[model samples]
Target: MPVTGADVRRIALALPGVVERASYGTPGWRVSDKLFARLHEQDGVLVRLGAIDEPELREVLTDAWRARAPKRLVAELAEPDG
Candidate 1:
């Protein structure tokens, strides 16, 4: 299925400290109050990830989250599972 705003919302919100809010008059996801993803008025979801695959979506969201998340939070993500 083609990716949609809901997909973006779901994936973005899964990351730590992610929040949903309005950005550029559309739905947006943020970490530390910094916008990481938003629904474009005409382009649907915008992350510049080219194809709309789930893995790419997750990667973009995670990278954006890491960039805006606190150091401690990012560090926790880097920790290997026990």
Candidate 2:
């Protein structure tokens, strides 16, 4: 099945300090208010991830979150989940 905005939202929100906001009138995901992913036309989303799986998408979102989040926040993410 094709990925949906809800799927993206679910994975992105799991990351440290990620939130959903509006971007160009569509749903966008951000870390510390820094945009990492936005949902737009099918083409736009596909351009970012060409046929990606859930695990891969999670990795991608985590990497994006790590890049945009504050140093301290990223460090917090490094700690193992209890």
Backbone clashes in model 2, listed as residue pairs: none
Candidate 2 minimal-lDDT segment of 10 residues? 41-50
Error of 2 at 5 (Å): 1.7
lDDT of 1 by residue, 4-27 (tens): 677888888877778899987888
TM-score of 2: 0.82
For each candidate in turn, the TM-score is: 0.79, 0.82
Clashes of each: 0, 0
- What's the residue-level lDDT of 62 in candidate 1? 89
Worst 10 residues of 1 by lDDT: 41-50
